[model samples]
Target: MKAAREARSAAVVINAGSRRGAASTELAVDAMRRAGVPVRSVHPVKSGTELFQTLRRVVADGHDLVVVGGGDGTMTSAAGLLAGTDIMLGVLPLGTANDFARTLEIPGGLTEACAVIADGKVVDVDLGWANGEPFLNVASVGLSVGVTEALSPRLKRRIGSLAYGIATMQAYARHKPFRARLEFPEGDHEPMELEDVLQVAVGNGRHYGGGNIVSPMAGIDDHTLDIYAILAAPLREHVKIARLLKDGSFIEHDRVYHLATRRVRLVTEPPLSVNLDGEIAAVTPADFSVQRNAVHVIVPQSSNSASFEGPSRH
Candidate 1:
């Protein structure tokens, strides 16, 4: 994938449904071209189906670069298509929570992001997989899934990043505790059974839930998945934990169990929806693995996030 691309052109795909997607599409296209990238095709797609088709076509067309605009969900979709391939991804963070972009230190402004695409270096980043679906940030079950359901488009457009907090609170009231077991495939840890869990999350990248850290030690290029299972607790205790979420110190709480491994398997009593980034990508009885250096992307030259050398695919 490190080899030179025969055609050095780039395609841009922006998800129109995202908060700033519709507003930023044309600006992104113009700014990218202005930044001196070899821009070819530009698409402001309104649906996931269209976004999929457009990304597939650009890859088939042999474009050297694929510039994706929108949130984590849109980036997750693009990663599924572009991972393990030679094409480089240029991100435009135009959604409510640009979690993946934040992990890479890719700024939020259209002009700044475009500049990075044009002048940045390429680096390989890991993607977490749940039942074969790819996610650039955290993937989880339980209350997080409810939060995803509560995040309506109108609500996000109105409150921006604050929407995540509002939705989490709204979902918390209706969250149902579930039972589950975790088995580490690498045998790094003994299998464990658990009961009445608020959430079980497997994180590949550091930032999620807007700007919350998965763990202080977690990193997208770390080649390991960060796993955390928070035991359901009393309201008074949970409020204290919520305060620690922003700094990822919540993982140190007595109720929050944390581990880092290459892979793990999660099984729930009554299969529950799994939230991958923001989309419900899978259900329980899930197999989770770290796709180490699964995707190559552009990031600011000043970013300390990923290794500049490309991935060595096994």
Candidate 2:
């Protein structure tokens, strides 16, 4: 645990892209000032490495907390640096699908989010890793990757989640099945050939693909990872699954398989494209593992109940 003086003097780093909320970066700075917390610095980042570099500087400067203001991708990028460290991460949900923020019950509005941060109740959260990259939401291979690849930034900003919905329709028309072998650390291996598989999502949190609830029962503090495999199906079935997801009924669907594991290795007959926390990573065969209690997060004390509740696989 960091000392009180250290926590109060912590610096916050916000991704400029996360500036969509009404409480602009200026308000964040002003709030920090009002709280009598010194503003170490606020830096803008364009790519993943840049975010890491800024985080490193913040840590080296003895800042006890690192606050990120962008969407999931930006948060994932910064998470790798804070894992296993003493720095408490504060999130300002400014991205398209603030899935992590939603799970934490952090409001979308910046002012509310900042108020939560100012309260400064710290929580320990679990983070998952694919190879070495940190992902707070989910990572997957197959149709979902196709949809992510097809959606342009302009379309995403203009249409929001509708862009992914449109991409799913287009991807469904071009879907094909593939053979994959999933090997768990306990020596359980399952080899299956799938057709029209929407995708395979390995979730650390409960949401992905723009609030699609890829792993409806996932818990961030749990030491396990949720692996959700969506087999390719007809357009009608795919639409049905999408609808079921909103109501938390997708878990009972026949085409979906959910597993809880500490580590998983995926091998595909043909190389498959993969997305890690919404960012494209190398193609399959990928190795995934959970880093238990991997990072410290600054969350509201009021949300403590939900934070510790184990993930539901129902």
Candidate 3:
């Protein structure tokens, strides 16, 4: 244990709407108390608005750390408060996917995750912004926005991560290619246009849409956003690339464009919904940027030594 250096006094907020919220919160509270953190308050919020209001109160009350229990959506809602602030954020993955938690190498086990928070190895990590809105994991448009719209809570509970894959297929069938231009103003790259764009995902962390790897070498601490664009292709070609993506080797696929940059902008002919983390947060034309080392997060010691794959230029 590293002596709970960054988080001595803390407050916890659990999203009552989360699938595992109630059960996970009880276990997390007991674990936190055992880990020597004096939990100043514990709140169960029914909506993102309530969760953020509670978090603001917690920060005002002098709590140094805020432990949040929910899925990626809940995290994204509260990200505005935590990112670029002195307050440290601790996550308890109690929602579907929990993609950001996966990126941090945080265990899903309640007791194990608590131990990581208790041991307290805090480090800085990047935050992704979509149209001025902050997100912890990834933000996307096109197929993903459709997937988010169609995703049912019942399906998520029954099939877990597979639900995303199923929804992807369903969304893809109804999806029409949209024309979009991507500009990397900060990186000084030429604006690129795609006549047949299916989906564009910008990842602040490595994993998104469950456990799928956005970029093999992407890391939260790397200060760069990983961009993955899946263009319109034949069903057969899509199938082949899906296989490669499953193996974290999709970069070689021509239809799949990959870029690593600090900032970029996506402009569509007609504005499209942008799914940030897991919820539809904003709409394009959206500006995506990275706030380097903007958040302090607790993680296991081994995570500090974890290696992330970098962009592989083809």
Using lDDT, give the best candidate's number: 1
Q: Give lDDT for model 2.
A: 0.73
Candidate 3 residues lying further than 4 Å off, grouped into runs, are 1-3, 305-314
Report residue 222 deviation for candidate 3 (angstroms). Answer: 0.9
> What tens digits encode model 3's per-residue C-alpha lDDT throughout 117-215?
888576676778887898878899898899997789888877777788889889988998999899998766778898888888898887787777887
1 or 2, greater by lDDT: 1
lDDT tens digits by residue: candidate 2, 137-212: 8888887777877778777678776887888777767767777777786665554445555677788877677666
TM-score of each: 0.96, 0.89, 0.93
Ranking, TM-score, top scorer first: 1, 3, 2
Give the count of colliding residue pairs in each prediction. 0, 3, 3
**Total backbone collisions, model 3:** 3
Ten residues in sequence with the least summed lDDT for candidate 1: 1-10
CA lDDT of each prediction against the hidden true structure = 0.89, 0.73, 0.81
lDDT computed for candidate 1: 0.89
